[model samples]
Target: MKIKNSLVILLVMAFGVFLFQVYKQHQTQGSLNKTAAYYNTNTPDEVGASNVVTAIVVTYRGLDTLGEVTVLFLTAMIVGYILRHGGKEKPMKNNTSEILITAANVLIPGSIILGVYVFINGHLTPGGGFQGGAIIGTAITLMILADPLGSVKKAVLHITESLSGFTYILIGLAGLLFAGGFLDNRILPLGNLGNLLSAGAIPLIYSLIGLKVGTELSSIIASINETGNKTA
Candidate 1:
């Protein structure tokens, strides 16, 4: 009881400190920091992306984005390895509802289309590769839930993931060789802003990212589901 009370008191104190910090925070002046000012003034003209956040993420901080994807890939690999080696017992099965199966059929196609749209237009819109990939993963999860015994082609997913990652790296190297730096978006002509083909290589890079992320996530989910299906 004393330990519980102590923990509660500590949590309360932390919350109080957070609240104090929030209260003490001052409103920003009209002026931006140097980096922000630079991006604001030059991003549209230089990056040719109306979406400043997309420009910064896909170009200015692209190497960091690559690291983030690599981390996710490692996580998925670890999960699959662990699950594959885990002990298997007699598998328990659950019956899925007809309504759920029907719903999956109705929604999966639209979800995939929306995911593709989001990544393809990452340079011009609010959504990007990660968001689109998550949507695709969700659709796969829904499909699994609707039919647990259904097979997902692991080979195809693996190939897609590998190819996308390879292509992404190639594009980065192209930027380093032909453009200003690694992962630069100016390897190709920056089309008119707000168009589907604008933002130079951003859309292509983001599409590759979406494919890699989607396949990785799906592979992880499929591994988990297969383990569950096979385990007793």
Candidate 2:
């Protein structure tokens, strides 16, 4: 009975959302649906970011970025808490084979470097905090596979997680207080188009995001390993 009721509620809400979207689309005039109508292609070139999507994700819709950060934070916290003492991982010093270790050593640094480039060039490219951060986390994963016993510390991870969260929130508050609105872009020099230092707060945010994801994933893996889920 509960399942049937829940399904009915979900179906009703889904149809309601579909109707709302259709109404919204119908409300917009045909010619007004052009890219220029919704977003500024001019902003990307002016901001020195090659990627318009990056500009949109990190700058124009930074509030959404904040939400994404919050979600990642929450996920890391929830998973960390759950797996911390849950008896789920196996921490063998030799959990990974020698070949995997060698490969990870070779690949990890390169991946981290690429992640940095992505964050630095986010405004002018397709990558940003979310994408770059995920890559950074991947590097940490490689480090773990290479040396399962190499000392993954929660203290360090906590610092990274906290600092990144603080940095993101501080920047947002600065934007709100100084830029006239929350997550405003005017806090830093907007920079020239296609330049490395362009995009102002966007790159800064991305860097922090990279750090956060890297540390969070590292900690999660460590927790899982420590807990007892040693399938790897």
Candidate 3:
């Protein structure tokens, strides 16, 4: 026991030292001023987005964002596959109180509306596709809690996922064909900055992303809920 305690203490000391070294290194390196300045100055004109963060995410680093979405898609697919058999089993009855159910029903629509609003205004404001999708997913969670055994429209979710993903890829290909590079946000007219329809393909791409992510997360929620029902 003494030896175990000593080893634990040694490990903690080593971890603390490592963290201190990392902190010191980070302090010495400072911020990348040149890169920051360039993005700040050039992003507005080049991407035609009022929000530089949106420009970076939906335009400059679009491929990276796509890759992230792809990874999430794959994970969701795997999880759904693993839980497929659960759909055949009888569901455990929902036992939520009337007040809880009523609250969930009341809040779900508002959450979805807010989610859509966030993704729609992504290029003009602080929020974006991922944030909006998460909000929608939360609404789904509320619905599931209210009615655990209820079926989500699997066909609609699948279609939304497939269509959105296909459209995003097609838009990227179009960018490669017509614009500066792959996933370029300039395939269509940029229009006036801060407009709902402006920022070229940004709003469209992000809208697709929001829908895809929301549906994907909902599917995951469905799978988990079904699996829980089966076990119960």
Best by TM-score: 1
**lDDT per residue as tens, model 3, 90-159:** 6355688999899997999999999999999999988999999999999988988888877577788889
**Model 3's lDDT to the true fold?**
0.90
Expressed as tens digits, the lDDT of each residue in 1-232 for candidate 1 is 9999999999999999999998889677788899999998999889999889989999999999999999988988899888887566555666899899899999999999999999998988899999999999998899889988766888888899999999999999999999999999999999898889988999999999999999899999998988887744
Clashes of each: 3, 14, 0
* C-alpha RMSD between model 2 and the true structure: 5.1
If scored against the real structure, what TM-score would every candidate get? 0.92, 0.77, 0.91
Model 2: per-residue Cα lDDT over 1-232, one tens digit each:
9999999999999999999998888754566346655565466544445677776676777788778777877887888788656643454446578789789888999999998887776676677766777788788777866766656678988897899889888998998888767776678887776777766777787788778877777777777655554443
TM-score of 2: 0.77
Better of 2 and 3 by TM-score: 3
Give per-model CA RMSD.
Answer: 1.8, 5.1, 2.2
lDDT of each candidate versus the true structure: 0.91, 0.75, 0.90
Q: Best candidate per lDDT, number? A: 1
Model 1 residue runs over 4 Å out of place are 89-94
